[model samples]
Target: MNAVWFVRSRQINRSISWWLAITGYKTSDRSFSNRIYFVYLVIFFAIWGLTVLALVTSTVAEGLQAFDPARPVWLAAQITVVVFLAWWLWSLFEASRRSPIKFTEEDAALICATPAPRPAVAFAWLVSAWFTTGLLFWALAITLGFARAEIAVGGNPTWADAPFYLSAAGQLLLPVILLHLGMLAVVWAFGCLRLNGYHSQGSLNRYPLALGFIFTAGLVFGGFEGIFFQSMAWPASAPVLSGSGLANYLPGNLAGLAWAGLGMGALYLASRRLNLSRAAQETSLSGRLQAASILGDQKLAASIHLKQRLKSGSRPFPLPGRPGALALSWKQILQSVRAFGAGALYNWSIVFALSLAVLLAPNWGVRGVAALFWIAQLHARLTQSLRLDLDQWPLFQALPIRSSYKLLAEIAPPGVLAVLVGWAGIAIASLLAPGINLWGAALLLPLVIFDLACGAAWDVFRQARAELLLAGMAPSPSFLSLVLSGLILILFLLPFIFFNAGLEAVLVALLWGGGACYLLFSLASRSMRKLGK
Candidate 1:
């Protein structure tokens, strides 16, 4: 075998062994346990996959039968395209920040110092990263194909038709794989150029921004909207909307060809210009990030991510010179600015978009689910400021301010931001969805603040317990914490269910929200005092 394949195989084996060892399946003495564990995981995923497939087929059938202007298949196609484009741009943005392909310090010492071919080594790294990171996309492609196959067969078939299903999955998998491969290659090519000093990080970063701008402009003004949207939808919808033929399939076929051609071009560029020495220097960060993920150290992972963003191009936000409780709030703002800079705007934009979705949903049931999803996402963002404080517990405990003030200060900034962003979304939704009760929408602004306060309080309390036991490292939130938090938030929203849209509902919601916030705040403050001790 060539040296490239040999190195790649060894790397894969080492990763699997590391994971197995961490899970207490030591190669020296636990061979049987390892095999048993592997079999258990396989069986679990197989059963889970079958259940998901059954749900998908049934749900798609129901959605198709529904009398709605936005057909389920078309909506799915739109969402799939949007997700793919977002991921593609994100990959490029990340590549600009750090090398897409990474080599460990050992690889630097051995491979970089040796006469191993640079192109071959780059290809191996690309393949390894793609296989490991692209598993989700592969599953999504298969699921999409399965959905399409059900549509093609005109009914959901029994298990006896497994061969037909497999053939359909195979048919769609090739194009999706090719399209994914092209995206990866393009990102890898950019990383190679950046490592070779052929492109400045700042300039490379602008590539995605520029492409996004051009794409947006085209949609608004360039009159290619229908054609662009039709690319993913045409093949899926044509059978139902326009009758199936070779013409219906032409767009998808052309797209596959284009992606394949693009992959070849990008690979050629990377092969000709990749620099091994610079790649070796840059890859250590990737190794650190990967290790943190494998060990499930979220704080370490966040720190590494912050460090990478700082390196990419961070703008300095002015810090307050005052020292005390106020300093904590300033530090939160500073950390957010330094970590995300202008990119934070997109986060708020998502809040507004999700709000619009929740308000526009057809029924209270759909609206409730969307609102819950929105709250879950908001809770994650709300905890960022609290985490900043928790990460520096030693210094935080040293502050002269009382524990209650410190806790309140930590949660205040993000809670305020959430209120403002969510209120903006509500205002827009009121304008767009005329049926929305303006009074109810306005009442949500305060509820948003209290909701964040309560959620942040719980997060602080849970994190304090974790930090106390784990020493300095704050582990990711446990499943129990998430479940409890969701339940608490649901209770806070329960007033909307008990009282219809009016002053009574608004008053009850305010009382419930305030009561929950106060209770959680008291608990969290008590926990913070323990940390101080």
Candidate 2:
């Protein structure tokens, strides 16, 4: 028994070490050039700047909520927490469906074959991977949570209060952790059921699967929201963690925390009843997300989804709305649609949610800066199609088509798609915050979309320049190139911010975005063609 425990611990430890090494730091032993070191220095400073920026944002959020101190702060927190769970549930559904867990594929057959209980070993692996990967994220969260908590207390926390803030954050995490654990265990159990052909299986069985997903997502949403209801009693019980105090008002208070732990434990124990045939299947959203982050460009990440078209032999369908550039635009739009999934138009919904948050948020200037940060992210997603064309630049160049035509076609699809989705987001956001001028919101959406598309296309140019600078001169797609590309994006987006109502802002954005689009795509096109020469 002791030996089994030792082996399990060892496996968990090794996995943790390997994941941390890969994700947290550079892994290659190869010598770096001076330019590489310069990139590292820039990243180091950028991380520090971001940390300070987050703390400042949190503090400002606290001040803004002070306007209506009674309900708004807690409401914002509830929304923040609920939105996250919604996204988590969505990702969980997609992840399990796309890549069903197969234990043998992960080389975990030895653990299953051992005397140690298969379920026990599996749970250990799950908890270890979850903890190791999530630790950094949680650490970051602690800072923001602390800032928010200080607001709850109607006080500003100082450096000396760090320990207290961290303790509060830890206490806050307990029930939430249990809630997440239960969610995960239930999902895993469902996976096991699928392994046995219980639900969401077989052809034409998708309706049942879809229903189950919606139902499950709703349950999680309701559960998390319920857990945070205690926040209703805040300020009254805002301090004490011992009993019937502020701790109880937090999302995962002690009683709820205990129940969640027990529920999750029961779920894991229940998994022991399953038949583990030499192996079981597993794939995770964490892996794909981490890969996308490491790749540092959405195009590289988006490529993974492009190869997933169901009818490989069939050609793309035309977009009747875009007759002039339909042939050029249709494939990109279809690919974005397919890759992003049905019922949702690209990631505009997420941007909308963020925009809503920005609108509700109090600090205009800081929030503008934060919006730029969010725009930087949206720009990454927008650029995926642009990068797709850039990747096959040699092929595009080899054709007899003029460079101007190639550039126009490449940028049009992504921009058109962005406008449609961005408008969807704007419409939804308008519904959420009725204070918004519908006319102004409608007018601003296209400029916002255009800005996002142009920024992304610009990244393709930045990357092309980097590769050209380092090509034959150094390695393929060097780290410095990604760093340089990101720096350029940061510089470009610094001036663009949200306007709840304005034609001036919109016009300015259109001019800047259009000019940047033309200039960068043309430069990138010319640079990419040079690669073939």
Best by lDDT: 1
The pairs that clash in candidate 2 are 101-281, 101-282, 102-280, 102-281, 102-282, 103-280, 237-246
Q: Give the count of colliding residue pairs in each prediction.
A: 0, 7
Instruction: Give per-residue CA lDDT, model 2, range 1-533, as digits (tens).
Output: 55445665776666545654543433343456644764775688667854674466466556647654765445445444544345445535653454223343234455445566646654655665456434543543444456555665557556676666656566545544554454455555544444442344434235335645654555466542454333532221232222212334544354445544664565466456544542343333234544565657454344444444443665645555544345456666676556666423436566656655544456777656656554655565566555555555544446565655655676566567566655665677677777866554455555555544544554455445435433321113333434444444443344445542356555655566557556656665565455432
| C-alpha local distance difference test of each model | 0.66, 0.51
lDDT of 1: 0.66
* Local lDDT at 306 for model 2: 49
Residue range 1-533, candidate 1, lDDT tens digits: 87776977888888877866765655556577778877776687777985686567556645654633344455444545555666887888888877777877777787767767767777777777777767776666556556656666667578877777666556656556666676788788877777764545557889887876765665565332367545533433332221112234556656655765776587667656566767777787778887888788766876887787767664555564468777776777666656775546776777677877876888978877777667666766776666666666666666799888887787777778887877787788778877767666566566656655555556556556544634655434444545656676566557777876667877887777777677777877877677532
C-alpha positional error of residue 332 in candidate 2 after TM-score superposition, expressed in Å: 8.7
Deviation from native of the Cα of residue 15 in model 2, angstroms: 7.5
Off by over 4 Å in 2: 1-121, 132-167, 197-244, 247-257, 273-293, 309-533
Q: State the lDDT at 346 in candidate 2.
A: 36
Q: Using Cα atoms with residue i matched to residue i, what is each candidate's TM-score against the true structure?
A: 0.58, 0.45
